[model samples]
Target chain A: ARPRVGYYFTGKTGSQVLTDKIKKLQVKDFQSIPVVVAENVSVYDAIVTMFLEDVGTLFVVDQGSILVGVLSRKDLLRTSIGKQELSTIPVNIIMTRMPNITMCEREDSLIDVAQKLIEKQIDALPVVKLTEKGIEVIGRITKTNMTKALVSLAIDGLV
Target chain B: ARPRVGYYFTGKTGSQVLTDKIKKLQVKDFQSIPVVVAENVSVYDAIVTMFLEDVGTLFVVDQGSILVGVLSRKDLLRTSIGKQELSTIPVNIIMTRMPNITMCEREDSLIDVAQKLIEKQIDALPVVKLTEKGIEVIGRITKTNMTKALVSLAIDGLV
Candidate 1:
């Protein structure tokens, strides 16, 4: 079993817990809706559906719950922007391979977490924790939260 | 002047305008705070204070309000973890310089957003957009939003 999660709202605390706070960021806030596709999902259909749903990211998973890879709208858009016969392509080709994405536990902190994003340069992180059942994802944190917090704290005097 | 920021949760319609969702997965989230440091700030003290603040990411900006580069926790952690006693080491040395990190606008669809945390295997993404005044940060996308969305949609059926 994994540990329970914790949250650090900047409104309640000062900036002293920034590093540790990052450890607590999760995927729970803006996961959108799970649009899981099989490994053999057609790239053409994925891109078409991407726009239809107005979603920018897709998780490519297997019959099991284990994470296999992720596909971004940019990947499909970059590929299909001008192509006409690209719909039949499989998502595995463009999706980010697994073991490459970072997973966080529910109880991690958002503090000092900015370094991980800066190092990788990607926009989002996947939150997970190890358990007897395996790695279970609990939530997510988006840069949007940063923008909100920055503005909030700046107005509240942390700037 | 900056736009008037507001926090209004999007019910089942979702906050993201065009992003794919994770399936049956819960992830971690973070409250990404935007903190800036001057170009001349001491790298040594900056690293120390950043850790104490527990924020993994820091923005290095100029007085003109232009974001120049980003410094991550790993950048400083590497120095501290490796015993790189070069205390005077500048953040510019280890930072993942700008024009390399993928940035996005707040109004953009979360569905098609790139995975900044996944690529670097880090936890956050810095959000910046072009404006008349210069480049300004709007928000960050992290794993936490992803987790929450997954739980709400895939596991909880909120989506």
Candidate 2:
């Protein structure tokens, strides 16, 4: 028979308790609905979509909504300021391509997501899941969402 | 005579060293050029400006560049999605008011700025200075900047 181990109490206090709670929390607990756009969309339209969606970062997907790349406000802003025509430019040109993007699974710990955000120097991560077709973006985890989680935990005195 | 205290090391290692470095860093050390827009500018124009400047947040200023309010991409996105006309809506109406805006001085510690970014549930903070004319917008400190600093420290093995 396998030995059963009960939960252990380490007597965590102060910020340590907060860290523990964050580590215990998963990305699915606070992920928000993702705002995505087609990879071939014009930068101008993408900007409008971003405004309409109330999101700073927009995931660029294919016709089937499969994750392809990611675009941020900075990318669009940089393109707009350039001499190139915004309406003629496609978002795929400036987006961070796949294999270079950092994403988190639903089961990823919030602390790991936060660390990735810092290490990767990005504002948000696309929450994704692996399917037979490949990776599909289901939601997004952002600094704002993490902050809300922290605030809630603080309010509840759990951290 | 005041007693002189000698510097002491607690023998921090690895991540602890990084934490100590981050805690000792100040906002001024990593602040970036601030993007500002006139309060009377239309939401459409503000979005364009944000794109042109490649910034997620824009500090709303008056004729003298005095700090008045703050606007984020989310604000513009929310407003653009609303029923109101985007071209006619002024940013001042949607911006976070001065009293409610959280700002940091140039001398503030980076750790404190990071904490405020979490506690207030905001991404960027305007780095301001108290002058005879009033508060002047000097720069901006953001999560991206903080992450860059952390990454650099990690790369240098200083943290």
Give candidate 2 misplaced runs (Cα > 4 Å): A1-16, B1-122, B127-132, B136-159
Give the TM-scores of the predictions, in the order they appear. Answer: 0.40, 0.60
Write candidate 1's Cα lDDT for B74-158 as tens digits: 4553344333444566666666666776665555443334244444554456667787877876555555454333223322223
Can you tell me which runs of candidate 1 are displaced by over 4 Å? A1-35, A81-84, A131-138, A151-159, B1-159
Mark the 10 consecutive residues where model 2 chain B has the least summed lDDT: B6-15
TM-score of chain B of 1: 0.63
**Model 2, B1-159: lDDT tens per residue?**
443544232443223433444456678888999999898999889988877776678999988879999998767655654567678989899999879989999899776777788767577999999898888999998867765554343243322
Error of 2 at A84 (Å): 2.1
| Candidate 2 CAPRI category | incorrect
Clashes of 1: 115
Docking verdict class for candidate 1: incorrect
Best by lDDT: 2
Q: After superposition, how far is residue B152 of candidate 2 from its true place, in Å?
A: 17
Q: How many angstroms is residue B1 displaced in model 2 relative to the true structure, after the best TM-score fit?
A: 41
Clashes (backbone N, CA, C under 3 Å), per candidate, total 115, 3
